[model samples]
Target: MAPRQKTAGLLDAVGPAFSRLRRSVLLDVENPVPAKDLTRTLVLNIVEDGADGEVTVGVVAERLAVDPSVASRMVTDCIGAGYLVRAASQRDGRRTVLRLSPEGAATLERFRQHQRVAFEYITRDWPEQERLEFARLLLKYVDAIDALRAPA
Candidate 1:
């Protein structure tokens, strides 16, 4: 096949590949933590990233590429689930920021563990070097995307 076609095929597959991964139960196996949807995972992750700076609902919206109201509802859901807490920002007491509750941090860690397990299981048959390279490249790809979306 031509190089352009090969690249197009790869790009075309990415969406469905991500969609399937999102819907997969592999990440939820063993039930390490209380059941929460992907949205909560995303919100928790965003809050964790905020360890370097104050994170608000608006920040969540921007990070999630969602509307402010939508992010508000999602953040509220996270708070209700006890995974996040609303607190006064240290930089500006009048502004509210988000923090991960103790349970939230543990839950996120558990999720990461399960994700690693799932990835290992899925690629169990691949050559070890290939698996390691894929893991490194995938992390690099995701980190690059995150950096692009990061707040200015």
Candidate 2:
């Protein structure tokens, strides 16, 4: 096959692989927030960034590759659901910041636990070295994609 065709085939296969992975590891279980993947991801991002202070909706939108308006609506929904709080940025009082609520933190922790269990189960038969290499490669792939998306 030509190189382009081979690349296309690989990209096509990735979608189903990701869908299966998400169903198996990310979404099949019950969650306290009862949110869709995007919303859940938004909350998780907020929680992850909370320690550094507050994260902005614009930053979340950029990271998630969604429109700022969409990110803002998701943030609003999370705040309404008691998963996130909006506060003034300490560094820049004029800027709005997002912080995950306690409930959101707990929910994120549960999601992480589910991910860990799913990975453990899925990799049970794999050699530890292979598992580690798989993880390293997956992260490298993701980082490469992120780098491509970064502003030059």
Candidate 3:
């Protein structure tokens, strides 16, 4: 195959592979979290990235490329599920800060553990060089996609 054809084929294969992997990792287990819950949790994680404490819902929404109302609703659902807490911001009384509850933290950790295990299993037979190369290429792909979505 020509280089462009090979690249297109890889992209096509990768997209479906990701969907399959996502479903297998997140939906195969008993009492699996629904897609919405998983998405909300991921948003929370993005908000908490490298942060010591409370983050505003707006920040989370921006990171997730979603509207604030959507973020607020997700936060409310998380709070109702005992996965998040919302409190009046000290710096801005008009705003609310969202933080993960203890249960939320534990649940997120469990999800990460499962994801790591799944990844390890998937790559168990791969050669070390191939694994490293895959990682580099995946990161490059992610960076390129993210850059394309960057605001003008």
Give RMSD (Å) of candidate 2 vs. truth: 3.7
Q: What is the per-residue lDDT of model 1 for residues 1-152, given as tens digits with 9 covering 90 to 100?
A: 99999999999999999898877756456554344555588899989988466999998998889999999999999899899998998889999999999988987887788788878788889999999999999999999997886669
- Name the 10 consecutive residues with the lowest summed lDDT in model 1: 27-36
Q: Specify the highest-TM-score model's number.
A: 1
Global fold similarity of model 2 (TM-score): 0.71
Clash counts per candidate, in order, are 0, 0, 0
* Model 3: per-residue Cα lDDT at residue 108: 85
- Residues 21-113, candidate 3: write the lDDT tens digits: 766765655456667767767865865562335587777777777899997787778788888887777777887777778988887887777
Question: Which model, 1 or 2, shows the larger TM-score?
Answer: 1
Task: Report the Cα RMSD per candidate.
Answer: 2.3, 3.7, 3.8
Cα lDDT computed for each candidate against the true fold: 0.85, 0.74, 0.74
TM-score of 1: 0.85
Ranking by TM-score: 1, 2, 3
Clashing pairs in 2: none
Q: Which stretches of candidate 2 lie over 4 Å from their true place?
A: 1-12, 23-25, 29-38, 50-54, 146-152
